[model samples]
Target: MKITFTFILLNLCIFISAQNDSINDKVISYDDKIILRLNLDTNVDDYVISSKELNIKPRLELNNQINTSFGLDYKIISATVSFAPHFFPGNNNNLKGKSSFTSYNFRFFPKNIIQTLSYKNSKGYYISNTQDFVSNWQKGKDPYLTFPNLRIQSFGGSTSYIFNKDFSLKAIYYQKEWQKKSSGSFIPSLNYEYLIFSDNQNSVKSREHQLNLSFDAGYYYNYVITKHINIAPFAFAGLGKKWSSYKSDVTKDEREKQNYFTQNFGAGIHLGYNSERLFFGSKFNYSGNHYDDNGSNILQNNFYVLLFFGYRLDPPSKVKKVYEKFQDKIPVL
Candidate 1:
C-alpha cells in the first residue's frame, strides 16, 4: 500500500510540473505542482535526574502542488514519523514508540507578511515498559508494549500568518478537537513539536489552506543562514481545550479535564538547492520541553532535529549564458 501510494503521488506531481506557466512578473504565478522525498532524524541525549537517553524516528514527506497566485498558493503536504526511545532516570532501558502527520499549505508571500491559511494535523503513538511516573533502573530488553496506546491524536485545519520570511502569528480558533488516551503520558494537556530549525526558504510549505482564526492562536518565526542553504526556524504558543483520557484513579477535577490548553514552541530548518524551477533540500526543528509540562519555557535551552530531501514541483531559474548556436538562430518574419 505504501509503495503504490508513493508511486501514484509521484506521477501526479510530475504531470503538474509539465503544466506550469512562467512567472516573470512581480506577482508569482504557477501551475506545476508535485513533490516527494524522505527524511531522517536521530538524537543521543541524557535527560531527567539519572539519565534518559533516546533514539527518535524518521519521516516520510509528500507535497503535491495544485495552483498559485499572488501571496496565495495551494499544495498538500503529508508526513509520517516513527520513533523508539529508552528512559533511564530510574535506570530502566526500555524502548517507546511514536508517530504523527500534517497536510497542505495554502499561502505565500516573498517580500510581504507571508500570511497563511493552511490545514495542520498532529498525532503520536507510544507504548511503555512498566506503568510508572518515574523511570526504572537496570538496562534490559525492549519494554515498549506494557502501557501501549499511551497517546492518539486526530486534529485538522486553521488559519495562520507569518510576520516576515522569519516570523509571524497564527490562529486556529475554529479547529476541531482531538487528544490522546494515555495515563501519565499525554499531550495537549501536553503539546509538543517534532523539531525546530530555520526555514527562510519555506521548505515545509504549509502556508496555504482553508480555515479561519476562531479558537487557537499562535506565533511563529524563521531565520535564514545562506541564500542557497536557508534556515527558517519557528516557534508556536497556543491556547485551546480538547478531550483527553487521563489516569482513571486520579482526581476528577475540571482543571484536569481533557480540555485544550497549550503552550508549544519549535522551529524547522530548510537546506535546499533553489532555482527557477526547483527548490530541493532538507529540514529539521527542535523544542525545549516535549509538552512543556517539564516547566522550562526558554526558547534557546532545548532542541531537536529533522533531516529530509525535498524538491518543488516548479524548478527555479538557472543562470546560463547565451550560447553561439542558439544566439545565431535566424529571426522569424
Candidate 2:
C-alpha cells in the first residue's frame, strides 16, 4: 500500500510538470509582436509602436516579416468639424467624417524614425476658389480681397525624426490641385516641430521666411494632446530677398527689373492642431506686414481653415500615447 501511494504521488508530480511546460510553450511570445499596422480606409498611420514591455521579452529586434493572419478583427469609424473665419479674428464654418479598420502582426523594432502615407477623397460645399478669386465685402467699397472657389485636391506625406525623445524634427510635403488657383503653385508645406522650450540648452531658435533661395534663421514647439489630437505652436521671424525678378512695362517701358535687394523683414506665428485619424487640421498663420494685394507694399493677413484628408495604407508610430499609461514610472528627462 505504501508503494502504491508512492507511485500515485510520482504520477501526480509528472502530470503537473507536463502541464506547466505546455503552458509555457503555448503562450504567445512578445518577440512575435506586431510592429507595423494598417487599418481599412483610415487616414493616420498608427504603426507608431513601442517596446511591448508588459508582455515579457519583447521581440523588437527580430528578422521576422509582417504577419497578416488575424484578418480584420476590429475597426474604428468617426467624424469631425471646425470653424475658422476670414483671414483672422472671427469664425468660418467647416465639417467632415470617415470609416476605417485596423490590423497587425510582426516582430519589427525601430527606434526613432516614423513615416505615414495615406489618401482620402472628400466632397463638400466649399468657398468658391475655382472661379472668382478676389472679392471681399467692405464698409464702403468691397474689402478689396479675393476668395476664389476653393476646390482643392491635395496629396502629401508627414514624416518625423526624433534625434531623441526630447528633440524631434518633423515636416510635411504636399502638392495640391485647385480647380482654379492663384500665383503660387500647388505647393503647401508644414513642419512638425518638437523642441525644448525654456530649456535654454538647445541653443537653436525657430526660423521662417517667405523669400525663396535665401537662408533665414528661427524656434518651435509641439505637443500631442491625445491619441487623435495634436497641437504645435511656433513663432519665427526672419529676413531674406526675392530671387525671382519681374519685368515692369510701366517703369522701364517693358524693362525687367530682374535683380534688386528685396528684403522681407517681419515677425510671424503659426498655430496648428491636427486630428490624425480624420486627417483634419486648423492653422492660424499671421505675419507682420510683408505681403501685398497685387505686388504693391501693404500690410496683409493670410489665414485659412485648412481642410485636408488622406488614407494611409501604412501607419506611423507616436511614442507619447504608447508610453502615457507608463509615464508615472518613466523619467521625463
Q: Candidate 1, 209: how far from true, in Å?
A: 26
TM-score of each: 0.39, 0.30
Off by over 4 Å in 1: 1-30, 41-137, 142-145, 149-151, 163-227, 243-260, 287-304, 312-333
lDDT of each: 0.28, 0.25
**Candidate 1: C-alpha lDDT:** 0.28
Positional deviation of residue 306's Cα in model 2 after best superposition, in angstroms: 1.2
- The residue-level lDDT of candidate 1 at 13 comes to 42
Superposition error at 270 for model 1 (Å):
3.6
lDDT leader: 1
User: Which tens-of-lDDT digit does each residue in 3-83 have in candidate 1?
Assistant: 323443443343333321223231223223333334444322212222124232222111111111112112211223333
Evaluated at residue 312, the lDDT of candidate 2 is: 23
